[model samples]
Target: MRLLITNDDGVHAKGIHALCKELEKYHDIIIVAPDDQRSATSHSITIAKPLIVKEVELPDIKSKAYSVSGTPADCVRVATDQIIKDKVDMVVSGINIGYNLGTDILYSGTVSAAVEATLCSVPAIAVSTESSAEDYVYENAAKYIKKVIEVAVSNKLHEDIVLNVNVPPIKDEDIKGIKVCKIGKLQFHHYYKETGKEQENLVYKLEGERVVNHVEETDSYYVDNGYVTVTPLHYDLTNFNILKDVGKWF
Candidate 1:
């Protein structure tokens, strides 16, 4: 199969490198990733400024690779529309350094890249690891990603949908199992706050930390508890239930 791979953590990230290594044996892979980390840049495109692309040299893989000076979403858009020109059969993003689950998906560039591919009518998967430990195991995550890709491609998983996968940080032996789940409601604990004085009528700096989640049976909960969470995401954001209520209000 022809595969297009991308990530939010930039081209030089170990996660993407490990993923490429594991996947190189099975598919014709093409990597187009951001030149720098754009972790929380959700579904954003570079429209105001010109985007640049540069070829990168990797040690083990013989895949075609390019680094783009844009967000993860931009990488997919450009790869499909400009670089490879719809030649890819599927899209996979990440093996991200940290998990993208529940509410975090709203801000995850890894999921956003896959979402962009799904919007372009391709099956996509976003893989992440729930690890903050410096010595966290990534090989398992890579291997799991390869398996997911194989299953997805062979089953011809819905083209207009993307899978958001979160792996536990523990060793492979410690993992309980994989769970197919729905996107559960999780809320952040904090909000952005300005840290520095305004400069030229603009806020100079902002910083914040996420608030702890309050819900159970969520992707966040599963990851926090050492289970791999697989949430299928769709491009449609419509709230069908609210349409009638909104119509009445209108």
Candidate 2:
């Protein structure tokens, strides 16, 4: 299969390269990623200005790669609509530095890239790792995705659905296998800090405290318990169940 690989952590990140190396061994790889980190960028696309894209080289990457001076979603948008010189079977995002799990994925550029692909009528997979540890275990994530792609491609995934995968950073032997689960409501504790520099006027930084999620049948819980979680996500935001009741109010 011909695959379009992209990520939010820029084209130079080790995670994307590791994924490309493993995937290129079996499928034709085409990488188009952000020029720099664009995490939590959501699904925003560049407009009213020219989107600058350039062909670049990644160390040990045999596939054709490009860097886009835009968000992760922009990379997918441009790649499918223009940058791609040929046909692509699927869009595979991430092997991201940190996981896009539960409610956190709503603000994740990594998942949004895959969401963009789905909007373009292409099947996509967004893979991420749970830990941002110094020893980032990416090879296992890549290899795991290989199997998923094989199954997904053979079965022909629905264009509206994206497979959101989150893997624990532990060794393969320690992994508790895969779990298909729901998206957990993982709420985070964060606050904006006021910088005390007289030279600068009101500079603040967002600092996070704790992320809480304990739902057993959800993505966060399964991943936290040593399992690789797979959640099938759709781009539709409509609350169909409430639509009928809302119409009655009129």
Candidate 3:
């Protein structure tokens, strides 16, 4: 398969490098990622300003690479729409430095990059690590991702769906197994704290505390208990059940 690879953690991130190393052994891979970290930007594109793209040299891997001065979604949109000349079989987004599970994925640029691929009528898979924002265990996550890619390729996925994967940060042997599950909660309580004032205006930063997902078989619970999780996700936000109920009011 010819795979277009990307991540929210920037072009030089270890996670993306490790993923390309493992997968390039089997598939033709290309990297188009943000020049800097663009985490949590979600589905945003560079509409107002012109996006800058540059071909870059990635050490130790030979696959063609480019760096985009925009969000992760911008990388995919520009790459598919303008950059790569050949057809892409799939968009494999991330071995992201941090998890993008549950509700937090709505704010995740890694998952959103794959979502952008689906909008382009291409199949995609977004994978992430359960590691904290800065952890050095990406190769482990990358190894599992290669397997997931193999399975996904053998059995094609619908363009409307993306396989969202989250791997626990552990040695390969210690990982219990892969679990196919539903999305779960990332934060139980959410709030913001006033950090300081910027000149005359008050500045605030969003904060949240996580609560365990006691519900079994969710992505949260499985990863919390040492299992790698894969959840089928779609971009459609329509509330089908409420459609008919709200029709009577009109």
Would you list the C-alpha lDDT of every candidate in the order shown? 0.84, 0.89, 0.89
Model 3 residue 162 CA deviation in Å: 0.5
lDDT of 3 by residue, 1-250 (tens): 8999999999998889989998999999999999999988999988999999999999999999999999999999999989998898899999888787788899899999999999998899999985554444688787888888888877778777799999888777889999999998764567989999999999999888777755777898889899999999988899999999999999
lDDT of 3 at 53: 95
Error of 3 at 135 (Å): 7.7
* Model 1 spans > 4 angstroms off: 131-136, 192-211
lDDT tens digits by residue: candidate 2, 1-250? 7899999999998889989999999999999999999988999888978889999988888899999999999999899889887777899999899888888898899999999999998899999995555443898888889988888878889887899999889888999999989899855667899867667577788998547667879988888899998899999999999999999999
Itemize residue pairs with steric clashes in candidate 3: none
In TM-score terms, candidate 1 sits at 0.90
Clashes of each: 1, 0, 0
- Please provide TM-scores, in order, for all candidate models, with all chains considered together: 0.90, 0.94, 0.94
Model 2: colliding residue pairs: none
lDDT of 1 by residue, 133-204 (tens): 544467788888888877776787988979899888778888888878777654354455655565655453
Give the range of the ten consecutive residues with the poorest summed lDDT in model 3. 130-139
The C-alpha stretches of model 2 lying farther than 4 A from their native spots are 133-136, 197-201
Model 3, C-alpha of 129: deviation from truth (Å): 0.6
Badly placed stretches (over 4 Å) of model 3 are 132-136, 198-200
